[model samples]
Target: MLELLSFGDQGWGDEMLLAGLMTILVSLSSVCLGLLIGVILASFKLSKSRILKLIAEVYTTVVRGVPELLVIYLLFFGGSSAVMYFAKMFGYDGYIELNAFTIGTFAVGAISGAYSTEVIRGAILAVPKGQFEVGETLGMSKFQMNLRIIFPQVARLALPGIGNVWQITLKDTSLISVTALVEIMRQAKVAAASEHEPFVFYTTAIVLYLLITTGSNKFFNRAEKKFSKGFVIEEST
Candidate 1:
């Protein structure tokens, strides 16, 4: 049993490790893109414009309401047609091919973004309004206020929620298997089928996922501690 997982062609260990790396890379890319999407959506949701708010609402509602696997499938199967349609408008008629990796990244990012949107918006709202009022009273520009006071507080408050989003993003990458991206889960499936060792491969995959999540948890905990050190309120006797 151990020989099956040994390195090189005789074993699937190297391939499994490579697939694990791919999984981490895809998850990281999705999380980064998701954070960007979240920031934009949160801004829209908090904006004064009714149209922006409506758009944000619809996006979050749809993404969050749908099962993540369906989202990945839709992006994988429908993405090419959608891209080709836009390409035709710009004098390009040929098919616009989107690889499985791109589709997986995008689908996971969109789902992660919906959750992140709420986290960021809540963080923004959690900031005391008086901080902004004080900034204005002191004649500080909006940019300065956001930089010096608002964003820092938001980051600190949003850390835990962002960590949750990261965890979701990591797990959601598994759904990308439908797109044939060959990440950890897909790799495990292949190895299991080939070696007739479903239990071993599947258990290995589970352990790898736990390692990633556990490491992420520690990282986020440290980040939360770092950000939480911003202000100190001392009592006078």
Candidate 2:
């Protein structure tokens, strides 16, 4: 048992470790992109234009409603088609495939971003209307008001929700197994098939996931505390 789990060519451990790292890489990339998307969607949601709000609403609703695996499949195939088409306009023609990593990141990121949109939008709304009024009265530009006054508070309030979306993004990467991305789940499947030891490899995969998630929780907890500094929250007795 121990030898089978050993590193180097003798064991399957290295592949498992590499796959775990891939999972982390994809998760980190997707979640960061998701945050950017979330911010944009939140802005659209907050915009006064009916069209912008409708666009935001449609995106969030469609992304949230769709199954994650379906999104991966759609993006995987759709992305390849889109890329191929764009390339043709430049007089280049060849079948192009979007790598699994790109597809996985985008699909998972889109779903995470949808959820994050609501979280961020709510956080923005949670900021007092008076703050906007104050910024206006001070003749602060929109950029200055957001950069100086609104963003920090929204971030502080949104941290917990964002953390939740991060977890969801992490778990959702497993769904990318269909894309053959060589993430933790794909690695487990491969190892289990080759070694005929499904239980062992799957358990190892579970442990790896737990370790990553536990570390992430700690990091987020520390971040929340750090960001909350100088601000006091009242607790009911």
* Structural similarity to truth (TM-score) of each candidate: 0.93, 0.94
Candidate 2 lDDT over 148-215, as tens digits, reads: 99999999999989999999999999999988899999999998899899999999999999999999
lDDT of 2: 0.92
Q: How far is 225's C-alpha from truth in model 1 (Å)?
A: 1.0
What residue pairs are clashing in model 1? none
Off by over 4 Å in 1: 230-237
Candidate-wise lDDT, in order: 0.92, 0.92
- Model 1: weakest 10-residue lDDT segment is 227-236
- State the local distance difference test value for candidate 1: 0.92
